[model samples]
Target chain A: MNHTIDDQVLAIGIPTDLLSTTVESLRAEILPLFDDTALKYSQVGKVHLNLCAVNMIDSAGVNFLVGIIRACQTRKLGITVTVKSRFVHRTLLFLRIDRHVELVVAS
Target chain B: MRVVETHTSPGNILGVDDDGVARLVLDQYLSRSGFRPELATSVMHAQQIIEMRPPGYFDCVITDYQMPEKSGLDLLIWLRSKDPCLASIVIAGAGEKDLVAAALRNGANNYLDKPYRREDLEQAVNKAVETTRHRRELARNEADAAAVGHLQRHLLGGRNLAIPGKVHFSHHPKRTAGGDFLNVHPCPDGALLVLAADVSGHDLKAAFVSAYFQGIVRGMLEKSTPIDEVLSFFNHCLWSDWGDRSAVTLEMPTSLSLCAAVLPPGRGQATLFSAGFPDAQVVLPSGEIRPCGVGGGHPMGWFAEALPERKTVDVPESGWLVLWTDGLEDHARQLAVSPWGLAYTLLRRDESTARRASIGDAIDDILVVAVALGSASFDEGFPILADQYAGDRWREIDAIQNEWRNTLTLAIPALSEERLCEILICLREGMLNALKHGCKGRPECTASLRFQYQSKARNLRAWIDDPGPGHGFDWASHAYVAQRDLLPSHRGLSMMHHFASRIENHRHGASLTLDFHLPEPP
Candidate 1:
């Protein structure tokens, strides 16, 4: 398991089983960790968001990712997101938001 | 020094003061000025006296600015807010300069310290009342203007087609609302009634006449009135309405040129009715034109007593009916040719496939040309025939009528073998005439041919309308020579003359209407 946290950045790589439930629960639980730094780092520069975990993003999970992107932009932060799943890339393309974000494929 | 009557009515003025000096100094001044005044103990009593009387009962309000819970400013605000037109003056004993300014801004007609003379109060009351009357008049005029706009929109009916189909229609008024109206409505018998009318004049009066005709036509349609009866009823109603108005006084009589149709359900059949409008045509599938007969009645609403005759013809299937206002006819005539050029332009082919994609597409193409030619407006592309010269005008009318006849002639190929042969024979004669006579002067002179078959009547008509000056064959002289057996080459004319029922020279072209009773459908 790997976990990294900084002033406006969070990267997590948990076990596949833990990732399944954790990703679903993190939308509500993890949002508060960045609440304090949200206003501080919002106007500074681009915010790096990396999630390298056991992968598959459902419709609801995709919606959570979009919500985070919007919150970062409202505070004037550019976002760079990386996902390993082909499903996530397809969803981004389907939603037409892929053009606005940098989507990196995990090797 | 000088005393003025602050209140015109003696009963309205209360002379009570703070020291309980009722009628002491004020009454003496009022008596000297030849004016009587009423007395009140407090502000509450004075308000009660004013309320008991109707508006304008008191000439002025001269009250102390301070009294119990209600101060003079409060009374002034209440009076101005309620009437805004009420004339009043505020008199304050402990007059602070800022407080006096506040009282004036709060709508007190005038503000004065307690030591102020009676003449000052009287002047303020008169000025305030005069300003109020002027403001009220302006509001009344604005209200009247809004009402007129509302009425015009209601009369105009706005731009919305009642039913959607291959045809599109519109009418534009140059004024708030002009006398022109176009209506499309479903009749009780499942037929669609389409009417376009232009009433005399461009003002509200003309619009009223148009609105009246719209109602009458709709009513007649709802009652299942036949096509002819609808025109006749409108004629009768307009005559009755406009005749009485112009009879007693020498005034311009109101009238309308109406073109109306009742399109039956199915592909191409409609019962058309027109009054003093340019001739309408039925374009057959094969591209022959047939002129719809027009009655010799004056336009609707023109005469006190005139009977209109209506002609009915069974429009063949796979044909298009083109109706026009006089504007379109004039435009065609002005160009010194018939609308054949327009029809050809609209129905032009790529030479590879001489096929019309759709009836709707044809109408759209022609309309585009009409607009480009400045013969029509975007909203309603009815050709304006009045602007065209007489000689040029009739040619356009004949051309469009001929084109309509040609469309039917072209459609005959699908009807039956016998009918097809008859149509071909007529077309053959027209083609030969074009090759021989039309192209003689200038070998490059081109002529087009259209053949139509009337299935119901079992008749075939062909039109070889040409742009050339005309054939020098002298049709009448040839008929004479053929009768005398003098000319040898008169054989072709003799053959066409006997073969076709009628070969008529139209204003700018010629049309050949042939009667072919096809042997009977198996």
Candidate 2:
């Protein structure tokens, strides 16, 4: 469950299993970035979540994405989610999350 | 010529020796010691003599340790196979301890050393004879019990009464006999009285009580006695009669856990009374299973006022009424499988490879009865996954969800990834709601999830229940507002509504069912 966060563009890497067990740690890791005004407002006009390595996602993971989307909306920033799993892509589409964020299903 | 007494001997002994003088001495000594002795020149001769008599005719066999061709150890081994109840004593020379040990290990009860005193001979023969007698008595008792068990199974097998609907019942006893019993009595008004009970033990006494209880029910019901009155009488019989330790010789009082159902001829109200038994399930025509309303009460004999808790269930025109003994539920929980799934597995002709392993290791006497009401057809909903979660152990949710994922993929291979995702999402959301809101994160509180697949309807349904007094909330209104306002808070319910083909809530929202229609199997 390795993840990486790019400070320059505010791009966060999601682990392979985006479940309740992993979401909490991911949330903790990203909480400080939200506190830094320079990272949230100045350096990044948009937040990119690279979920290309994700194999599965549960409701908690979906709720995590929703939290990120809500945060981006409050800060007047756009967000995009990139995933390689068709299941995850379909889940996002099915839940109608694509209406708010640009979802890219990487081949 | 010595006058040998034929009667009043303690035991009949078979004495074997290759030496002629030794055989004569053994015969004389045994006769003088108040025992009947038959002399055999060799091991083969001893076998021939013993084979002519009944199994327990000769109480003990005294054989010389060393013999031509076949030794006494060989005779001891053969005697074990021929008559395990018969005991053997080996006569060995001094310093032949190894041979004596081999004879003892091979079924010789005791060994007599060469040049032994009359007391030593008598002591060895007496102990061996007593051992043989005890073993023979035990064998006789076991044979009798087995015969009775055979009769019980035969009688119970033919006890499936004629009812309006198609009755499918299965009983698997843990041993030759067990406590689990079922009887169906057809009433005068075309109603069927079905009783499934599990007596306390798995022995002959339990089987006897089970038969007696069924007979009482049959007699009382035939006399036009009210169901409640009949139950009351039976409870009193247990509490004051069988279960009373003061008069009964039983070490512990007998308690009977049972569930009785009165299913009408057609679609009507069905009466269910459960006394410390698992809840019966009603499988609707749509394949939705609803457990009996009455949970359970104290088992009969537990208290003087241990009345059966009664509940009325609306029977569908064409559905299934399922009843089972608690053994099925206990085993299902021990295996972490769905009780419904286990029942269906035991009922169906074909078994899944995954489930067959669990069925082979059943630890209880299982009985399941499923009656189709008012029709010949009932949708078979195969349960694939079932689990319970403590409200405080939410951290294990991911691992458990993955297990469900594996089971669903294996059970319904045609289930597309998209539909599986929908199921897992709804399951997590529903469980989270149950744990966080319903259970209020109490460690003692718990929630359960059951997933059933209806192959005929191509539908997968999830049933989730939490032990909580659920609050009133219009989920539809919340979903509508959440979707319209793009709110993140209550969108999980909206997602559930969107993904599931239908949603049903029961027990004041404590129980939730979500159904997703699957594509045609490829």
Best candidate, TM-score = 2
> Candidate 2 residues A1-107, lDDT tens each?
33334554568787657776788888887777666575645467778889998877776677778888888888777788899988788778866788889898888
DockQ of 1: 0.01
Q: Pick the candidate with the highest DockQ.
A: 2
Question: Against the true structure, candidate 1 has what lDDT?
Answer: 0.51
Off by over 4 Å in 1: A1-107, B1-162, B227-229, B245-250, B266-269, B329-522
Alpha-carbon TM-score of each model against the true structure: 0.34, 0.66
lDDT of 2 by residue, B1-522 (tens): 334334354999999999998988899889999998999998889989988987678989999989999999889889889999999888999999998888878888888889878888988888888888888777876876787678767766677734433777767666667788887888889888888889988777887888788789888988988788988998899888866456646366788988889977765789988888877878776555677776576688888888989888888886778888877787766655456666665665354633552544667778888887766342556455656788886767776676676657655656787678778877877888888877888889988888877778888888889988876777778765655556656556766777789998888878988888998856
- Candidate 1 lDDT, B37-124, residue by residue in tens: 5555566676677678776555456566666766777777767765565556666666377777888888766666767565654455
Instruction: List each candidate's DockQ score.
Output: 0.01, 0.25
